[model samples]
Target: MRLSIFAAALAAFALTANTADAQTRVTYKSAKSGSSYYQMGVQIAEAMKAAGDISVTIEESQGSVQNVMEAAVRGGDYVFTAPPALVGAARAGKGPFEARPSPKFAEIRALFPIPSLTMHFVARADEGIESLADLEGKTILLGKGSFGADEGAKYMTLFGLDGKVTVADAELSNAVGALKNGQIDAFVTAGSFPAPNVIEAAAGTGVTVISLTDEQVAETGRARLVIPAGTYAGQDSDIVTTSLPVVAYTSTAMDDDTAYALTKTFWEQKAALGEAARWWNGVDAALLDNITGQIHPGALKYYDEAGIAVPDTAR
Candidate 1:
């Protein structure tokens, strides 16, 4: 009897040790080039580590679509992505996933909401193009492959801009260069408040950012977003334009207990998570309510504990 009791205690110790180590080994996958997005992931990882003995790692990922697939396949543990890409992946049933159609769609859940991305129409000071309609006959560089490009394409189709907006597809870096060289009348990109590229390009070039006006803002809200004053390139200045809201998405492959623990830790250490990245500014405990789609049980539990009401749809 004494020997059996000693053996049981030894096994329990090993199990406890394994559980503790599991929390320390949290890993995430994100894009290296997108500083803002990647920074958030790092912050989450750090917060997780600081909450316990967890060691967090962030690996370079392809893009939004790729990241989602990685998380679905368990190739990665966590991921951040825009809404459209996440939705598209959940429907396709492939990529970083094994599910044919709904693979991990229901399992993945929202972790955080990011600032809206402004889709700016940048024109040369002398171009005389006032509205998106004015670029009918002029050459325009719509951001390519990037989210901005994909959104722009959708906007053109939605607004019936087929013949009215003759846009040339080019990589963001190349497009910026082309715009500087007068190869394209305008360079467009969907980005966060104070887009680094636009600000950098406009520093000395005298570029102008156009707004969607009240009507346009409402119209674009159908597929994208538009932030109010003081959210753009200038501080203490009003910038009225349409944007695309970004959300941080994580995989559903995480076991319920692990996800629950991390979710609980995240809320408990919310301050640390926000301090980890610039994009997290203004994020409040309530903003978690703004999310669409399914909510992970762990997140739901955390929110419940905080007295935050979870929508029936999310459940």
Candidate 2:
């Protein structure tokens, strides 16, 4: 009888170990480390772990454009993206995705929205550069190995200053140094208001946050956003610019139950996460209306229970 009891106990332990090993592990792909999206991804992972017996891993990625492609290719279980336009473009095989469009792009689904990353143009206060046109004939630093390079080039073309201005590529820190030393007349970047690099540059040298004129804003096809007065030192008045929404997304490979759990945990613990990151303060349920892709059925399940209407187009 004693031998039989010990054998049963060992079998039970093996079953328990197997159950733990079988738990689903989700991989979350976030942008560059130390970015707001990375921090937010960590928070989501923690919340999902706390609310359910699941494992989550955070992986650093290049940026939104790359993240969307990875999600389409099943490279990761979750991805964070911005502007929402990238999603539409990837699905329709246009813009950055024009070369090799993936039909898998249509299987991508939205999870939630994060804050908008505002586009900022910084120039030396002494330069007398007041608008996009003023960038003509000036040496501008378009961020190295970043989406800003393409965006800066586009801005110059849109404003008819393409051939006139000398565009240079440099990392953020090097660009800041060049800007402070008068080597570069303007620097273009995009991120949450009062971006750390912008603040550092402003503190080191007098800087002007350039604003887009009504016509430029209209021509760019981006939403106009404002950096409220005094967001940074020497920034005395509100600066108007364009912005893109950051959003969380997943692929169809994610099961409905897992999606439901993650979506539910995200909203329930958002306040707590917001406490850790100021950028998270801008996350709003209303922004769900801005999502350009389909809604995951599991996420839709929770939203339906909450009486939040997801557009039929997203279904």
Candidate 3:
């Protein structure tokens, strides 16, 4: 009798173990540790966990360029975020990916639109900073090895403030405290609006979000963005800037059902996500117009069921 009871208990344990192993597991790769994108990844993982039987592991990355480069080795259940332009560049074997083209680039597919990368040229308001040209003569921290650093540097050069400004080599995580302590006069960070660092800076100290003129905005050739007044503490008027449309993506290796479940959960929980953070509100079906590559069949299925039309360019 004792032996029969022990065998039955062992069988029950095996079934329980198998049941626990059935959850779908995915790896979500986003930006560095302190970034808003990284925080979003954490929130997404939690939301997906609560929604159903799925497990998402959050991974830190240097930037979108690195994320795209790794897609070849990390196909199945690997989700990464990048601007649509980067996706196009990777597919064309141009830009950063030009060094070595991979056929895997052909397998890249859009999962969903997250948020556009909005440019914020934050400065000390007490210093009377006002425009892109004002950035000249200021010390700015644009962090190394990041899309923001590269884009910020490019903008400075494009707007003709490159040589005039002193670019600090500090990591972006230190940007707020550096600005608060007067260690740096300003910093240029790129992320969705109401960027966490920007909010902290504004609340911690007197700061100004430099507004680009129509001509400056035109010269950059990025999408126009207006930061509504009161989005932060010290701002009283609209601040116009530019943005690069960003999207979450995966490869053909991720099975259709896994991709489908991920997409469905994202859309279904987006509203609640937005209620918790305004940045999520920036994403919408209309933003699909900015996508440059094919949409995952699983994600497309969800879009069709919801009546969201994806543009032909992304088909």
Candidate 4:
């Protein structure tokens, strides 16, 4: 009788163990190091850890393309990417994901759009370089690798730069140093200012941060975003041009329940999240309605329970 009872208890334990194991583990990956996406992801992972019992993990990855592939293949459940990349993948099915046609877009959904990385180009004040047009035939430290190359391309398109613009493949720090050493004519970066790298670059390099004029800002805002002053560190006195917004995309594969829980948690602790990510300061709880994709039913339920107005689209 004792042996039979022991065997029955062991069987029950096995069933419970299997039941607990059934709860899926979700993992997220972000672009390489020194990126806000990676940092915010680390913070979110911490938040998930604090939430308890939910098995979630966040890892560093090779940037948007790799991330999207991982999500498409189910190698990862979520990824932090940019709107252009997501839309490009979904609309053209040309980049990042091809085996899956653009129609397979439903495989991924856009969770939310966050502000872009504030980008700028800095040249020594004494260099006689005043406008984007002056970058012609000048050596500029664009970015570390592909990221830097993209930054350079954006500016080139923005200013319609036609001169010889030399780009150096260097990290932010080295890029700044290159400017100071005359190895490069200027340094450009897209990040929060007093961004450690920019701050270091400014200390003695006499770097002058430049941006588009008010009219330019207005024009760009029509196509993109233009930030008000104080968005980055040096904007108040050091930067002469208006700021533009660079939106980042979040992983959309989170189930309705998990998405709801995460969204609810994000708003509930808005204060703390804002403190961690400066851009969150602009997020209004009401903007929940403005989410581009369908809000998870769980999130919608949470919004209703919270008494927040659900936008018509959401409804």
Tens digits of per-residue lDDT for model 3, 47-106 = 899898789999999999999999978859899999888988899999999997899988
What's the distance in Å from true for residue 184, model 4? 3.2
Model 4 error, position 242 (Å): 9.0
RMSD of each: 6.0, 3.7, 2.9, 5.0
Best by lDDT: 3
**What would the TM-scores of all predictions be?**
0.70, 0.79, 0.85, 0.70
Candidate 4 lDDT at 298 equals 54
Candidate 4 least-lDDT 10 residues: 242-251
Question: What is candidate 4's lDDT per residue for 1-315, written digit by digit as tens?
Answer: 999999999999999999778654666666677676677667666665566544557777876666655554563245355544354555466754666664434545444334445556777767888778788888777765555457556657776773468766676667766777888888877654335566676676766667666676554442223445655444464344433332333334566776566656656656676787665565555434334444446556777788877666644
Best by TM-score: 3
Model 2 accuracy (lDDT, Cα): 0.80
Sort by lDDT, best first: what order? 3, 2, 1, 4
TM-score of 2: 0.79
Give the deviation of candidate 1 from the true structure as CA RMSD. 6.0
C-alpha lDDT score of every prediction, in listed order: 0.64, 0.80, 0.89, 0.59
Candidate 3 residue runs with Cα over 4 Å from true position: 134-145, 162-185
- What local lDDT score does residue 64 receive in model 1, on the 0 to 100 scale? 67
